[model samples]
Target: MRITGYRALNTVQEWGRAVGDANGVYADGLTEVPMVLVTTDEGITGVGMGPHVELDAVFAAIDGEDPRGVTALYDRMLRQMFKAGHAGTVFGTIGAFDTALWDIKAKAAGEPLWRLLGGRDRVVPAYASGLDIDLDDEDLIRTYQQYAEHGLRTAKLKGGLDVERDRHRLSLVRDVLTEAGGGARPGLMLDANECWSRKQAVRHVAELERTLDLIWVEEPVRRWDAEGLAAVGRGVRAAVASGENLSGLEQFRPLLAAGALDIVQTASVWGITHFLRVAALAHGHDLPVSPIGTNPVGLLHAAASVPNHLASELQVLQPPVGVALDLRIEDGAFVLGDSPGLGVVLDEELIGACELQPATSSFDGPGVRPERAGHRLLAAAG
Candidate 1:
């Protein structure tokens, strides 16, 4: 089916400072969210979440391309992106549109998106992420304890602003996990969110390791500095995991080939096709793959289909309204519905109740916050 039309929605929600740990200050008292729904000639449609920045440009490029021609279209997008100087925003569009394309293809085929992607397992492990350093000790303990009670065996915390504070709170995470686990500790990971210099990352990781063994340290130094990332990996006792912020395969290739990353963290922002491609790259290296955000539904499918794949990250706090997620958590893992395509839809009722006016200007999110994001941690503070 030829791609036909697209619709975009920008949503804003207020979870209050108590519940927000987004990277930038939502001084407008709202969080910005966006989604794109792509429709095909056959009337099949799929929804992908990301900013609607370049939907028109992407549509113009892919209008007549067969949605089923996945490989060719992907290559086309890559070439266009490279020509555009690999502009960061356009990559999000590429990822988002790729998702809608897969959704249309799978719906047309009458199979669930996961099965279309060749995934046998419908259930995928998940880790709680989106914690902010702004949260206090009690919030830290409570968050881990909540995860433990959910039967989740692992959770990653946000850190990297202050070495001593990170250690203190992480120690509390250990205590809560151990106590919640009946004296056994649940697995732990941390995202410094690329807040430190390479030297600071090395020293901080070493200090944290002295008191608590981490499953891995994520983006402790720089998100794009492969060499610096490699150095931090070499210095730390914990495994170094990154790539959630990277766009296309080019960014992943250098660090991955150099053994800078111990785990591959892909978000749905790269779409499922690219996700699988990157997974293959990591798999060749015998490293594990994981998802780093509340990714689109297609990503969970890719993770379950592969052997080295591990848990997906879900924010402890999603917008209290607007979005509808068909995925559920059972025993702390994500359970996908056997519905065709992604099985996610916009909740008009909730959206009406919760939606704020979309920001008129650009702002950063927890994912790209020049600062580490909030509310999940802010909620804990309350």
Candidate 2:
């Protein structure tokens, strides 16, 4: 069926507790979730979740094209932004449309997205990520206890501010997961969110490694610093995982060629096509690929088809307000239902009824880099 038009809206995810990393924290734990609905001539509408920048310009490229030809249309959307450059928020816009088109293609085929993507298994392994830098010790225990109840033997904590505090928090989470696993050795990970310098990353992770057997350390240095990342990887026993902030495959080429990243990662908001391509690239390098996002169900379908999917980050247990998915997290994995397409159903009325918070400044927010992030090294030296 030919594409007709699209509609965009916003919803919020109430995280129940303050969520942040080394960058910052939202005290209210509320964040915006933008959505796009692409409608076709045949009355089928596909849903995609991401930012809403340059939607009109990006959507114009595939206005009358067949939604089933998703791959070609993805390239078309990228070319539409060739002169303007398709990085940052614009890339997310393209990804939103690309995922919606894939949703439509799978729905038209009358099959679940996993089956349409040739995934053999419906279950995708998962690891809990709480974004819990602002959470207190009691809240931290309570947070991981919930994930432990879900049978998640692996968890990633948000840290890199203070080594001693991070070590204490990591121990708490590990104990909880290990108990949940009946004394099985639990896998633990840390996300510094690119707050540390190369030396700081190596030093901080080396300190934590003395006690915690970490599975990986994510974004220890900046997203584009291939040499710094390689240095951190060389110094630390745990693997280095990054690339969620990177926009395209070309950006990953240097990191791959330099043998920098041990575990490659891509954000779910980057779309299925991008994740699939990144996965293929990582596979060629003999490295494992993981996905990072709040709701990564769409990528999980694609992840199921990839041979090198290590694990997906499970940020929140529930879907965003007024949205539902045809999937469930069971026994430390996400099990996809037989719902066609992305299995996302939205209640626009409910979303509209919900109160909207004031927009956060670009310079602030959990994922944004803090002003004095790496400067702490100077204080420590003094």
lDDT of each: 0.72, 0.90
Model 2 C-alpha lDDT per residue in residues 228-331, reported as the tens digit of each score: 99999999999999999999999999999999999999998999999999999999999999999998878998998999999999999999999999999899
User: What stretches of model 1 exceed 4 Å from their correct place?
Assistant: 13-30, 317-320, 349-354, 357-362, 365-382
Clash count, predicted structure 1: 13
For residue 346, model 2's alpha carbon misses the true position, in angstroms, by: 0.8
Give TM-scores for every candidate, taking all chains together and pairing residue i with residue i. Answer: 0.88, 0.97
lDDT by residue (1-382, candidate 1, tens digit) is: 7777788866664533333331433344455556778877877777776667666766777777778776677667766666675446677778787887777777788877888888888999887664545556766666666667777767677776556777777777777767776787677788877767787778878988898889999887667788888999899889999988787778888998677899888877767778888888888889899876544467887787888887788664443356666677777788888778777767766766663663424444444455332212221121
How many residue-pair clashes does candidate 2 contain?
A: 0
Q: lDDT, candidate 2, residue 131?
A: 95
**Which candidate's lDDT is highest?**
2
Error of 1 at 235 (Å): 1.4
